[model samples]
Target: MNFNLLHEIVLGFMVVLLLVAVAVIIERFIYYSYIERSRKRLLGLLAKGDEQAVLKETKGSSCPHARLIGGMLALKGLEKDAFESKVQALYLTQQAGVKRLLWMVDTTITLSPLLGLLGTILGIIDTFNALASQGVSDPQAVSQGIGTALFATAAGIGIAVVCLVFHNYFSERVERINEQLKVMALDQAGAVAGEGSGVRGGREPARIQPQAAAA
Candidate 1:
């Protein structure tokens, strides 16, 4: 087998992985942007404290944050333990949507470097084969072959690094969004409880401000 051909194959695989990673990144960005816009609208409704409006938006909306908050609102005034359990269950159910496409990015991150190394090895083997078949009278040819072989490793590492950075960024955003949902749910729940009990003398309603939840 031609070592150059093998090297090209490795690089080709790396390119595919990179493209996958980039696609995932772009998709996640669009998804998260939509989530952000939906969240802002929901927060605006929440700030108005119009129960009907909030319920209407939540009912018609597709955002997980909206649905999560809506579920919490629907379950308001329940016992703390039961409320928390239901909220947690809701969060777990919605997690699949929030984490979509992230696995592809992760797969690219894990495979890029290994594929690169494989390409490099194939290149080096080819180089040695050439030396065996023909005397190494031209030292420059050996050096060039070795250098070309290393491109596979470099390409692999480059792809992995790019994927790693985006993966971490998306992961962090997921964490922040998750935490925001949880906290906002709890805050709204508390606010509802406060309104129901008529205990306005002590603590104020902790309606989570939308601005505070910015990711």
Candidate 2:
């Protein structure tokens, strides 16, 4: 019934938590709205061996995964070692981008419980202080302190739960995409190498003819 105590318990932490939550929601929306579609298009282009099309599709986009695929395509004629190196570099870059903002989600999950514990400690301290001043015989005053203390713990756990769920789901999606990328890279590499070998084998070295003596 006492909102003042609830406000005191939630206070600044609630605002911070709300902001973090909003950020996560926005990130998720962007991922699904734009990044997800781009990924599907990238995969399709890779499957069709349309490197130019893939590059064009991702040229203006900031998606890391798309950039990785494009980078590999750019090295199409390079030797195996060079191509692999380029691909690996691009893969690492894309991985980092995919994992961006994940740390914040992790931090929220880690901090939520601690914040709740802090609230609980403060509530207990307040309750004991009240008891000392007003006497232990007053149950109503004691209840107020205990109730306020529990609010922090509840909020912390709730925030952590939400963050954990999102983190796990996003992580799984990323893993699946990474797997697909790996497979596509291997297949493309083999196809390109085979073509290069066939061309080299069919070609003959140039022969030089002696020049006729000048008068």
Candidate 3:
């Protein structure tokens, strides 16, 4: 393939697109890794029965899921409903953070193919113009034009494919983390409720039962 043909097909913008795609991939890898590590640490703390310690540790970590769990843990002594509310609020905030930049990923995937198609059209038009100007007498000129046009289309489709794969992979990871968070919240709530009832080893007296329990 001629270097000029490759350049024409890529429309000078392919490099920029590739760089952006690579940056996205790297950013996602780092983000997910951080979240995963934070989650494991938080869960380990929870398993060890150090809920307060987990909350304090996560408060300084800036991890979204950790923050949510911290919020739930902070309400350990609150009523069940209040605790649930705080957990839900924190969960929402964490989810919003997790979803950040998702739209940009989607846009990048969508735009890549369109840009490729535009390059293809431009390449083909330039080739046809050359043919017309040269009276279509030279087969070499015609072949060059067609090659450039096709190259642009191929590059665009290739970029789009990469972006789409990344988008799907990252989206799945986000969903998995979100599900885990929901489970954690419910478990924390159950633990809090149990502790409040005198079901645990602690001998703290249970709160007054409802009037119906006395009847």
TM-score winner:
1
> Candidate 2: misplaced stretches above 4 Å?
1-11, 46-51, 191-215
Instruction: Please write out the lDDT profile of model 2 over residues 60-117, one tens digit for every residue.
Output: 6776556655565566687766666666665556666666777788888898788787
TM-score of each candidate structure, all chains considered together = 0.81, 0.77, 0.79
Q: Whose TM-score is higher: candidate 1's or candidate 3's?
A: 1
* Candidate 2 TM-score to native: 0.77
> What are the per-residue Cα lDDT tens digits for candidate 1 across 130-155?
99999798999999999988988898
Best by lDDT: 1
TM-score of 3: 0.79
Clashes of each: 0, 0, 0
lDDT of each: 0.78, 0.64, 0.68
What local lDDT does model 1 show for residue 191? 58
What C-alpha root-mean-square deviation, in Å, does candidate 1 show against the real structure? 5.1
For 1-215, candidate 3 gives per-residue lDDT tens digits of 34346445456677687787788788878988999998888777766776557757678776776776666556667776666566666666777777677676687677777777777777777776666667778888788778867777787788778888988999899888877766665555565554532112122332322221121
Residue 73's lDDT in candidate 2: 55
